[model samples]
Target: MTVNARSGLPKDRPAAPAPPPPPGWRRWLVPVGVLITLVLLFLPGMGRGPAQVDYGDLAQQVAAKQVDTLRLTADGTITGTYASSFDGGEDFVSHYPTGLQGVDDTFLSQVRDPSVVPHFQATGATGSWLGTLLALLPFLLFLGFFLYIGRAARKGMAGGLGGIPGVGRSKAKVIDAVRPDTTFADVAGYEGVKRDVTEVVDFLRHAEKYAAAGAVAPRGVLMAGPPGTGKTLLARAVAGEAEVPFFSMTGSGFVEMFVGVGAARVRDLFAEARKRAPAIIFIDEIDAIGQRRGSGMASNDEREQTLNQLLAEMDGFDPATGIVVMAATNRPETLDAALLRPGRFDRQVTVPLPTQPERRAILAVHAAGKHLAADVDLDTAARATPGFSGADLANLMNEAAIVAVRDDRTQLTAADLSQARDRIILGQRQGANFLLESEKRNVAVHESGHALVAALSPAADPVDRVTILPSGMALGVTEQMPEEERHLYSEEQMLASLAVRLGGRGAELVVFGEGSTGASNDLASATGLATRMVREFGLSPALGPVGYSSDSPQYLGGEQVTSRAYSEETQRVIDTEVARLVREAETTAVELLRSHRPALEALTRQLLEHETVTGAVVHAIAAGSTADGATRAPVSA
Candidate 1:
């Protein structure tokens, strides 16, 4: 249903709201606004005395005496009157200005008693009863509206603040009908991932290949990748590439906080998918319901039950039937191994971060309709982003265009793109993080050393940006963009890049003869990299040239393989090797600092003043660097 943003009403439903009849309380508001406005308008003149008489004692007195001949003064004060029955038109010649107070209090003695003068004051009151009712009209209208919505939610028309009991059973989205806009062109890099997905797409597109050949095509492919790597999008691309129905829904959506519903929903999803033969079921974030059993989740028993149902349906795949399943999740380790066995998932494809060329392609695709400034170099932009994924690049383009729009520019410039990049990567550089002079100096030196060391290393690339300004998660950041995109890295290059990760700490220690905690992130990054090199890359002498564990998702996904990757002796050797790398890199950075002390001071001073340093600026000092590192769901239409 289409909704009208202005009226907050359903476009198709055209409700005849009875002019909302100035809700009982809505009537109160206008009178309230008027009353408030009038109070504001009239209260200021409370002391002003008007020429009009506020006291009407004469009018009362005349009425009490039944004086028809009473006269009103031009000053609106009572001046003349005489209609005393006792006087019988004799006209009493007694005179003083005729105010009711001027008469004697006891004028009529007893025989046929009559009363004398009285006192009067004109009282002003505003906001009649009708006006007050109108004033509160709006409030009453809103109350009725919310009540209607609340009731509707409870009755299951629109899922209430809490869904109706049967809602969990109805959560699966029929995706082939959804037909997302993503195709293969929308995805880039990860050729290995594409190759793995290609087989599945081929099977969906040509069901006869396996049927005629007496071989079964894979029934499912589990997409396992780190966050921001476009796993969900890859699923959409597969759907776009295939000539079958696609059903997409998140794994988490199947498991509501409500109990017993997850298992029922899982069964329902597969049953529905099966009915749509030659269909693709893409469940993004499958780990939500696919976690290992006995994880102490309160619903572990039920969740595992849900997993069992899902595995059974996935397992009993009949190629002749033409139904397939694909799921995406970052935490693949948590899933049940039974769900990912060869007969079930059969394959795992890893969608990775885009290479430089791929990033440029992604940028171009996103920037297609936007006006570009002459200074916007696609190569430079791609190089400036080393770790950005396809989604990040797309977001960068969107942010740049937004900046251009905000600044009222006809085109997006390189500087605008760079600013947008920083905004996306580090968050806005807020002015609120005021730093002391000493702290500022220390941060500048630390970041500048990172820039210089990366630039000086042959394995590392030139520094793209170095900034001392604070962002969402950091006091400062130094970014290094690659010269070109790289996939495979040499052992030397990896080691060199690791050295630069230690450079900031090295500079702090060498310059001040001690170090601060500014190197926390860098230390963690270096440590993890060194550890991976040992455990996975076989860089440690204790474990050479072979991965001890089958960490590959093809075999490891959903499995509960708890054995250590290496023996205790091997772990000690691995730790020593990592420490040796860190210590050696520290020594190298210190030596460079001692030799280029003057230049180091200059760079840091410049950073303090500018708050940002460019790649060219860092290259001018040092010259090296390297290292490394969705899905429409458905359409109701």
Candidate 2:
């Protein structure tokens, strides 16, 4: 279906009008003159013949009165139309050496009588440097023409003077000399993704069996996931397993400033791929060119033209041709519908964040060259990194190695891995031990608030670790680790989470008599979750089963132009509900902190002394265990 670039709507095809012919005689004038000049420059001796006649012989001929017509030129060359044929033509000329005393006009006039042909007659100018240059002009023009064509063909021009024939040809890199050294084995985890791509490789390897079974091969495969999830690596693994040609290009590489250039590149790419059957063409970051047509305000004719060409090529290719198109995009939702159709990118292999086991495998793969101490456990590291992608895991291993090097140790220890995880998650510790005593006390109370609330709330995730030590953008952190990844959240759990987020502010207000900016991050998080609960999750009674919030792409972030989707009155109600949810959660946190002031003070003292505390210690303290665990502590407000 052809889409209108402006409206993005499909319509009936209209025949294109013929282009008007160029106007005026001037259009053909330069070419005609050039042709004539070329012919004249190389024309066989118009009125002259080549002959090495001696000057004395010419003078004898003139004295014998054999020369009828004599012509003298400005350069002192003399030509005469012979009375009878001399060489092959009627005319011949010889240099009248100017070395002698100035030419004798009377003697020259005597060469021919005035009655026959005028003596000392004027002739065309003799050959000089100017004439030599004119003679080479045609060859020079031809050389320049070829050179321009070569340049244009080699590096596609952007149009205008740079316009060269075949400028639309694709700049796609052809990898024929070197095959992908990476196989599926080299890639860690993503067993499902590997299985998906492996089928394509299998089809390429044994096409005859599938053909006999009456199965048509998938034309294209799309790997969609977050960035650095091993999409490109998986495509390379497919290429390696198949062991065929791989044509690699990015979506941006197709388009040029000139119109139709992108379309030409798409054509050229497929043509090249078709020539090498059983080949894989991988396009990285395909969202750049594959976005829904006519969706944006600006009309991009070049990009649309390229997309049309790509669609045509994908539809035109035979599955049996052994050409598979593979593409990777972090934003698959943005791609055009035509591109994701069954005949195009029929297979979509989603590469999600690695699971705990997968992360362990990924760590092991990246840890191959590194020396790990006996205490360093991949399982423990994997458990610490839940939402980490494959790339993140690889980076973790690299950072751990760096940490080991910084400590001047040859082997990576558990501490190194833990520090690396902290760096990756919370960022590097800032200000180190530079906090003032009062600031340290404040930070301790702030984090203690969060840890205490999480421990007291039955539905909240357990605090993994808490510290008053400043890191990155935060003055302190309260890290929570879920025992198992939870896909669904209960209302009570969400409420508890919101309360925990507000715990720090509630704690500060209770002990210090006022809240501080240190709880700014916690407030923001709690507010957002409360708003989501009311507006999106339909958890608010006032906003009852209605979603007023914008529907944003889950992974890509940001709303997709969705508005409030409700009346002003309903919006007010939503705002009221959101505020109420946050208030209720904050009130619960305040009440909980007020009831456990003794525990808060004890935890704050521990934080100020240790600067960091584990969730186990917080749990024990919250359970009424003494600081030394020998005596029970009474909880008092």
Candidate 3:
């Protein structure tokens, strides 16, 4: 089967042929009818009928023997042919004065001369049929306009923009069962996630098997994870594996500015899904419309109504009907509980960040068509990345390729991958010419301080690289990578982390007798970590091992306001403990830097020379070895 490049759907069979066009003459029938109607409507006005003449002028013309013919109607309108000499016109019309009984004697005296009088006739008559029709033309046009508006109103009532078809309909893109493209094989990792969704795929492919066992399938599955964890990709894999119709949409698609439009869209979406039974309806980012209802004044009535309709549809659909709803959201904590209940989203799959092996696998998948140098070790790259998601890994591979292209190289090398990782984590590197010599020296010292503390601290992760080169918002950076993945951290490890974070500030104070704004981010990070240690981790002795932090979302990063559960006096204690922890960490960093003053100076000087230094060189300098691998005696504080 050939795959469509744009849509990624398979084309195993030919598309259905379009209906034949109508007969040639029939195509012009509507346009011809419209033309005829317009001509008939405007024909009377198009012709210049008769020129109006005054009654006195007509009498003078008749008395002068210039009038050739005359006909007077009961309504006192006189129309007749006249000599061109009378008024340079052959035909004329005149209205008698309404005050006159008939053609008055004054007007009749002009026609009394037998020689002057032309042909004359008096007839009590009404207007011709065409004139009558012309008189009602306005009413007919108004009726046509009213019908056009009424038709538009009816279309609007049917949930469509007036005259525009399918504006209010669901915007889901449906993939036919035969066009399933991304199977499980295409997904690199998330084995557990794939396993969890496999049952749904099986049920979709073979509903009779479950029916025979009297087992009901789950109506919906919710994939909750951090952003870029491949939740949507997993849903696509399910569609491919099941070989069933796939209806995909985002939660935000259901909402519209118009009231009741969101609910209407929800109904329309489900109706379309029902028409394609055994289909998988995947809604990406369901939290957009599935947030907890009536939470606060921020609650949106339209979104709430949409959520209500979705709940109704999910509950209303039968498992036997073979329609499974799958939704994904990074902010699952914000979703309404009804969506996660049994019979709705019976299963909630958590797609967390990839482990080292999974990262390696994901890298391999993204690297399939890319040209890589022989020395580019993906395993090492994976090990360096601890908390990277599948999408991040994919982006990493692409960024590495971009780096290679930027350097005018065809094959991505290890250096390209390393630079890409640094760009991702520490932001893009700034030009070397941007920093002044003095600023560069200070940055070198600051980064050296961080590297020294991280290398010396037993509980801290190993320093990976140190650089005086400015990147992103920072003038310098010291990156540390863990030797292995760690799910939990000890109190010592947290304290060590705090010290490493404050190392730059400590260096600033020790070397320059002052601090700079460069440490502002470090201070904030240290303070927040210390606060969490005291309040959430219950690490502070004064806090009595009691957790005090509110339950905020784990994956979704945002601040939430919550009233402190503890008293004001307890708050004071909490603050005191947090300050003390931060002070102790800073003090440790200061003392460690002071003791390793010679090593710090050596590392800083090396950074000044090279602008970038590896962890091995930093480790060597910290262990009483010079930058050139020569032995040196350690200096005391």
The prediction achieving the highest TM-score against the true structure is 3
Which of the two, 2 or 3, has more lDDT?
3
- Taking all chains together, each candidate's TM-score versus the true structure is 0.61, 0.72, 0.75
TM-score rank order: 3, 2, 1
Let me know the TM-score candidate 3 reaches against the reference structure. Answer: 0.75
Any residue pairs clashing in model 2, and if so which? none
- Candidate 2's displacement at residue 83, Å, is 49
Ranking of models by lDDT: 3, 2, 1
lDDT of 1 by residue, 456-531 (tens): 6667766778989888677888887766677788888887788788889888987888888889998899988888
lDDT of 1 at 98: 51
| Model 3: colliding residue pairs | none
Q: What lDDT tens digits, residue by residue, belong to model 3 across residues 1-637?
A: 2212112223334556775685799789889989988987787689687888998878777877898778878888888887666666478889888886654776666555456656777889778787788799899999977786576566455333324455467888887746567888888888889998998877777766777899887989899999999998888787777666788899988887755677877777777776666678999989999999977656688898889888888886332245789999999888888888998899889998888888988999899999999998888898898888988888899999999888898899998988888889889899979898888888888899999988888788988888877778888889888888788999889989999999998988889989898899999999899988888888888978898766454332355555667898988998899899989988999999998898889988899999889988888888786557643344332
Give the residue spans of candidate 2 off by over 4 A: 1-167, 317-320, 548-562, 626-637
Give one clash count per candidate, in the order shown. 29, 0, 0
Index of the highest-lDDT prediction: 3
**Superposed model 3: Cα runs more than 4 Å off:** 1-164, 177-180, 298-301, 317-320, 550-562, 626-637
